[model samples]
Target chain A: MRKIGFSVIYFVLVSVIFILNYTFEHTAMVSYSFWNITRAVLLIFAVIVFPLLNRRIYSIAVTVLKEELRKKTLYVIFIFVALLVSLIHVFGKIAPANQHVFVGEMGLSGITLFGLLFGVFMSSTAMYKEMEKKTVYVLLSYPVSRQEIVMGKFIGNMISILLFSFLLSLIFVVSLLVRFGPINSVIVYSCFALMLEFVVIVAIATTTSTMLSSTSNIVFVIIIFLLGHMTEKITHIASRLEAQRLKEAAEVFVRVLPDFKRFEFKDALSLGTVIEPSVIIASLSYALFYSAVALIIGMLIFRRREVDRL
Target chain B: MDHVIEIKGLRKVYRDFWYRPKVIAIDRLDMEVKKGEIFGFLGPNGSGKTTALKLMLGLIFPTSGKIRILGKVPTDVRIKEQIGYMPEESYLYGFLNADETLDFYGKLNGIPRARRKERIEKVLDIVGLKHARKRRLSDYSKGMSRRISLAQVLLKDPDLVLLDEPTIGLDPVVSREVKDVILGLKSEGKTVVLSSHLLSEVQTVCDKIAILCEGKLIKEGNVDELLTVNGETEIVASGLKQEDISRIKDVISSSGGKFISSGHPKETLEGLFIKSIKEKQESKSN
Candidate 1:
């Protein structure tokens, strides 16, 4: 049932993107067509890379999956997302004739919000829980590398977050179809961008958890998320600054933190604006690059960390 | 003469958040655990026994020094395939049932599915937890959880088993059973490194023992050699009358030897506890 559901959603998403790309191309919207093509390419690339995961990484990931399943954390989060999505009608009723757009915005926002909560909460606690419980001793005693543990955890938590996001997005899609009547393909692009943002959040949280306590890690991740979203504005302010040193400091901050605004498509989706394919590819590449760097830093810290601290 | 574990000048100094040296857990420790022997690591609380165990298992790094397990670096992943470790506490995933816990560790060791299935059952039976294998570890008593911990350590049939206070909270009966399992592993030519504060238990099972105090080895030798009294002797005999006792005393006096006090031998509390349980079982069978 899950596979079929996922397949149908996937097929519908692809078909919609392609159909929109053809329509936009005929109307001379080259940028929109290119964006769709990039989306299709990224989808294909993800499908290809997922199945070739390492065996050790797969085992750790499976353990994390089992832990989450047994703890029912995923179930609770799914129920919350579902309940929030279902409650969107209350907001829809208060809106004007374009109530469908309001509903879509609320539904997507709920998915992103709940998905971030789950992602940040789970990732920040992943390593700390293992240490506090002393389970890392047993795990490290096995024939697995510390890098594998960090990577596996990042992969596992990512999977859980993605699964929940997928479910919530499905509900949102259904809600859109029922109320909005053949939802725009831009919504699909927004969801993809939201997922990419989650990938960055998970990586940062996972990396921070290796060195900090869970609470501190969560705080740090949230601060980074906030700072990341303000990168462009911060950089603009730096460019306008009269003090050279302050301008340079702000510019450095901009360079250091991720530009989360790059992954924001909600405004475009709502305004029915076209996104360029090059922009989509560049945003995805940036996310993947940042995630890899974060994961690498996390693995290094994890490898050097002493389990005796807990 | 083969050493399964070797450590030399090992030091572990823990640091605070500011990177200031806070505690010196192990200080220039040197030790070697030979193959196929049950080596006991005896120390008081906070005496660095657990720290040393963690260092040996590569769960923690040393500040300065070297450690090798199974002739490989402690952190070498390949060495873990033949090593089993049970922490001072159970440290198990509370969400996983006993069966799942064992299965999880088995997978980490990269054991094949067929062998893991067979060995999981075997280890569970060895630890007398076969009946409760379906129960979540969180629901288990302290003793039961320790047994499951032991079961996971033995799941891979590891050649070198490092058990840190394996019988800490167990009942006398269960402690005896755990010691027996340790001995059983020795009988299979597997090297067992056991750390505990229970001196009697260590004396009973360990062929050689090392006592650490304040992160330093105060003593290390054969159990009997370290425990033996140079000038004293104990003699036990049955059905001896008072006259026989006097004659023995006379002989010792004539030889300029002092006779120590003598009394009927008494079983230890642990021994008596185990014996009574065995007798109860025997009577029920009869």
Candidate 2:
């Protein structure tokens, strides 16, 4: 929760810079380029707030590393996030001229990819490792609720991931400022959008991990991510299917799947567009709604779990 | 006086993909431990001893039973503050040294800094791990890590302590030291529930014994009463001949005593090692 609070604070730093830039630039309207800054803000906002909405990720991590501070696995994950962010930045640099996207938009995407993957990996293994090693039995004996134990693990892991994400984003931002002379408002908005999207994905991963094995949970979360982005297409195919009943089922699936397309504020960033305040507010609401639902489901599953195994 | 723990008809059924019928891990178990007593739970593998302990600790809920620890439900956060536990397996963070781990747990229980420091040092001394306090948990051997975990439970000076297989991996000397620690806790009027498979370990330290088998209670009573009632009557003859063994059994039977076995009495390895360590300690104290 601290990490989430801090991340939210860190995200607004870019917005502050944008407000200052707008004061000097004499912009008549919050220009198309302002979308970039909004997106950046959203990305950070989502990462911080998402953990609170669905605690499984944060709780699992906390449980794993709370007592021991020296597990090199945490440091290794840091290195992995750093390398992933750098690799994404490199890929963004080599894109074709026609595909020239803003660096802020590119950076947000990198955060979502790396952050979500790391979230799932940590969440899935948190309780599984404790049970396998019989370490969980110690905590179970305490009068502490399973919720506290699960929440502790998720919070602990979230802090680590937040550290990694923040460090990587900080470096990316620094590089952007050095190359582009103080990233415009366009980058901030782009980052914000990415943060919001990653939160939803993190929640999905966390919720699945309570019931599924580590590897299976990761696979399940990845599939959800993939399908989340194609709900519209699914709806389209459902309309065209030969069987009417099948099409009806597909429609229901579309409604239930997270509308990953709605999270796409990148199109606005590409044109350097200013996102309306309403859109930002709406996107946040969606992220929060998804997070709440996912967490409720995760909690229900966890409530019934046999503590002996974990 | 508040009973530290009370359970009525505790039962646990584990359902997994691998098993056809759900595993009845615990069945209709009823027991209680008073405010301050060294209570031992004894059972063999698959006997539901660990299951019963887990239920009492409220690590997992009983399928159809009720348990109260310290006058509250097992899952009550308030009760957790007053309870300390050492599991059969160490669940410590491998990154922190012994001292750091203790500090983390102590703080969680809201122990103030200065007192936490004193407690850390004191508990490490009790567990005989003061020398290894600086070593990271990952660097410690199995026995060392277990000792650190034991130290962690005691650091909070909890009102109730639940220890499951607390001495499984320790050396004989260390195990004896742990026995002494348990005795010390008993003297302080702290309730201590220890679960172990070694009958002798319980026989030496436990005031009361609860024996479980196949998820059912086979017997439970004070050590003195149970031993007097169920223990085999023995006769020692210094100059008995081989043919006299049969006669000895008949004579014992006629005397209303059941003769179970005859053998040369020898000190067990663990017993000898513990005796030697105790002699050294006594000499040092003198």
Model 2, docking class: acceptable
lDDT of 2 by residue, B94-178 (tens): 7678887787676566677899899998988877788888887888998887788888888878888888898897888878878
Per-prediction TM-score? 0.90, 0.77
* Model 1 alpha-carbon drift over 4 Å, by segment: A1-52, A276-282, B282-286
- Per-residue lDDT tens digits for candidate 1, residues A177-242, read 776678777776777777888888998898888888999988988899889988878988889999
Highest DockQ: which candidate?
1
Which residues of candidate 2, in runs, are more than 4 Å off? A1-109, A182-184, A239-251, B16-20, B229-271, B275-286
- Residue A142 error, candidate 1, Å: 0.6
User: Model 2, residue B140: displacement in angstroms?
Assistant: 1.5
Give TM-scores of the second chain, every candidate.
0.96, 0.83
**lDDT of candidate 1 over B106-210, digit per residue (tens):** 887888999999999888888889889889899999999889888888887899999999899889999999999999999999999989999999999999988
Query: Candidate 2 chain B: minimum summed lDDT over ten consecutive residues — where?
Result: B228-237
